[model samples]
Target: MKIAFIGTGLMGYPMAKNLLEKNLELNVFSRTIEKAKPLEKFAAKISNSLSEAVKGVDVVITMLTDDDAVEKVLSDQDFQENLKKGSTIVDMSSIKPKIAIKYGKLLKDQGINFLDAPVSGGTIGAEQATLAIMVGGDQKVFDQIKDVLKVMGNPTLVGPIGSGQVSKLANQIIVGITIGAVAEAITLCEKAGVDGNKFIKALAGGFADGKILQNHGKRMIDKDFSPKGKVSTHLKDMNNILECAGDLNTQLPISNLIKDMFKSLVENGNDNDDHSALYKEIERRNKN
Candidate 1:
């Protein structure tokens, strides 16, 4: 199937390449053309305009940053006026489920199909094509795109429109809290004269062990705060979660607490650092 891929950032770059490798007729665009250049060598055509990229494509996938970026890109005249009827828009950007729902209905009205399919697994997963994709949209549409989606990751139809984002929010909550737990545990252990790196080894295979403990935990011990997922980005997801929770009259005290911690990291100029850098905030707290 013909495809248009937008937002060629860290994750988007590799993802577009995966599609190109699959011999798909792929068109690509990024707000910054330089980011889109790399895909050209992989036989992916770079479109100078959003409409040019999306026009006549069977599937248009957006892997943008957040709600605002996604809105800004999708609301463009090129996207609005040019996308042909019956084509599908697969938004892989993390956004509010309600926003996803809002746009889904709007797209449906215009004879377009929209799927709110957010993902996990960070850049590593994107590059490896093992990311877990949670999709929310028509079952029929999902079935049609299942093979295409599988090229990127494991795609699961969570529910009707917006469920993918809801699933992502739940994912961020667990990830944020687990990072908090690992960070605090490491800090406390180090302060009490234990080796933080060895601590992780000791905890391996236990209930406290999981992917976070292995990957993010190692990052914490090594002070490797590079961005797999930025703290600011996680903060955005947390806010989305709290907002969703508010609409449902749900209380999320821990999520709120972790949200504040991430906010502090952003305010202190760690916004672009890895979310695991939440360790920096906890370390600061212990010192004071």
Candidate 2:
């Protein structure tokens, strides 16, 4: 199938590369041409313009930074005009549920299918093709594109349009809280003269054990804050979560606290560091 991929940044670059490896007819576009140039070596057609990239493609996949970036692309007249009728647009960015639903309705009116298929799993997962893709769209459409998605990750059709983003928000909430919990526990143990590594090992195979505790806990222990998922990105997710909650007339107290922690990190210029750097924030709090 002919496909167009936009936003070839950190996560997007690897995802588009996986599609190219499958020998699909792929056109890749990035506002920054350098990012798309590498994919050309993989036999991807690099488009000079967004319209040029999308024209006549059966599907267009976007893995952008945030809702604003996604909206800027989707709202472009050139982008809308270039999309062929009956084509599908799968947005794999973590964005607001309301925005997803908004675009879903707008695109549906034009006979185009839109799916909010946000993902979880950092850059490593993107490179390894093990990302947990949560999809929200028509079942039939999902089935039609399932194979293409599977090239990058395991895609699940959770419900209708916007559900994928909701699921991602839930995932982020759990992630933020768990990171905080792990950091706090690890810090407490360290303060009490306990070995953080051994402490985590003690919790292994117990209910507290999870991907976050194991993977992120390891990052904490090693002081490796390189960006698997950036602190800024998680901050954006937290803001989106609270915005969504406010729209639904609900409260997320723990998420709010986590949001502030992320905000503090970003304010202190840790925006580009890994989200696991939240541990550093907790570590700072215990410094007395």
TM-score of each: 0.98, 0.97
Residue 13 CA displacement from its true place in model 2, Å: 1.0
- Measured by TM-score, the strongest candidate is 1
Instruction: Find the candidate with the highest lDDT and give its number.
Output: 2
Runs of candidate 1 exceeding 4 Å displacement: none
lDDT of 1 by residue, 107-185 (tens): 8988999999999999999999999999999999999888999999999999999999999999999999999999998
Report every candidate's CA lDDT.
0.93, 0.94
Which ten residues in a row are the worst by lDDT in model 2?
279-288
Residues 1-288 of candidate 2: C-alpha lDDT, one tens digit per residue: 999999988899999999999999999999899989988889999999999999999999999999899999999999999999999999999999999999999999999999999999888899999999999999999999999999999999999999999999999999999999988877788789999889889998999998899999889989999998999999999999999999999999999999999999999899999998998988766674
